[model samples]
Target: MKLIKLDAIDSTNDFLKGLSVTQELENFTVVSAENQTKGRGQMGAVWNTEASKNLIMSVFVKDFVLNPNGIYQLNIATALAIIQVLKTFNIKDLSIKWPNDIMSANFKLGGILIENTFKSGGRISSVIGIGLNVNQTNFDNLPKASSMAVVADTVFDKEKILVLIVERLKANLALINTNSQGLWNEYLSILFKKGVPMPFKVKEKSFMGIITSVSAAGKLVVSLEDNSFVEFEVKEVQMLY
Candidate 1:
């Protein structure tokens, strides 16, 4: 549970990744920054957060050892951990959007970015970066964004939320290590838009589709109007808001 706190940095993910290259980081080692100048999000988008307000951190999981084919378990575990903590705050309409974005109703409350490193003999280490909107309520420019304070109508202590998330993450990781099958089912149970027809776009074409399930490899499984199920990798399709 070694934690490194920084006043500011470019990206916590990059910082931990750089350290993992030259050093053997312990499991649950965390690097958190008060402000990230170039915070990264999924699909290379920049994550914007007010200074010293949100949770900007990266966690190191050593000796993950899980099969590469089951990497989605990592996403499931991380997302569920965040959802559990948000539930304690009584945040309404909590859901995990595909590939691990925490959402309240339709607004994004947090996101996860996981980077895995493979070593010899099938060992894996994961550097998981998480960005959660905590107390920052202003999102006029970003219509899809919301924070714990905004949705719950109460200000939250960012550090307290960080500690709770890390604790829950460790617990979730332990559960997945033993009962991945059960955890997978729980993830699907709380998945957003599951079995509901939603708008999506693929290559400038829009269509309505129902999300059936996610593949073990983390592909989105969508059932279209033609009753054909299609699996799509991230970036191959976009879930329309």
Candidate 2:
């Protein structure tokens, strides 16, 4: 894997996208920044992290041959890879909040944002942007945020953690090539609030529902109070605390 370490950048994903347009990039190439000035999150939310205090990086997956119809498989693979890496550190209560937000207990530890470049036929490449709270101890107003250091009661080498995650991602990609079914099953097993009735807000309406499973297209499948199942794409509904 080729790794590019930047001192600072607007966004690692943007940098990787720029690189892709300017020159050819190898598969599994990684770009990490000590400071990401314009770090982003799912649905255009800002990923706020103190400079050099968290893992702000993007991985380029080039020429991956997986069918675009099962793009959620990529989401499953990425989430599981991060979870596996955190498990090595003995982090407890790890769960993937719908789609791919990494949570420990009730607090969020990290998140995954994947952007795919597609040809007319199928997906060509992808840039996976991940932001994990590492050494950042204070969330200030963001009550749900927590870091690996705070959760583990010890400091960690950010670079070492990033490397481990990348390695696991490569391994998971290999597994995807061989066992997509296994990866999908494992992802569902670790889903947050699965089988538990939880409050959700659908636009202006609020209701309780249980997360049954995610669709192949990455929609959240929820079994509601009326015994009917509804599928919601990202941001269509909010998982309420």
Which segments of model 1 are wrong by more than 4 Å? Answer: none
Give lDDT tens digits, candidate 2, residues 71-129.
77778888999999999999989999988999999999999899989867665789999
- Find the 10 residues in a row with the least total lDDT in model 2: 62-71
- What is the lDDT of every predicted structure here? 0.90, 0.90
Q: Summing lDDT over every window of 10 consecutive residues in candidate 1, give the lowest-scoring window.
A: 62-71
The clash tally of candidate 1 reads: 0
lDDT of 2 at 25: 85
Candidate 1 overall lDDT versus native: 0.90
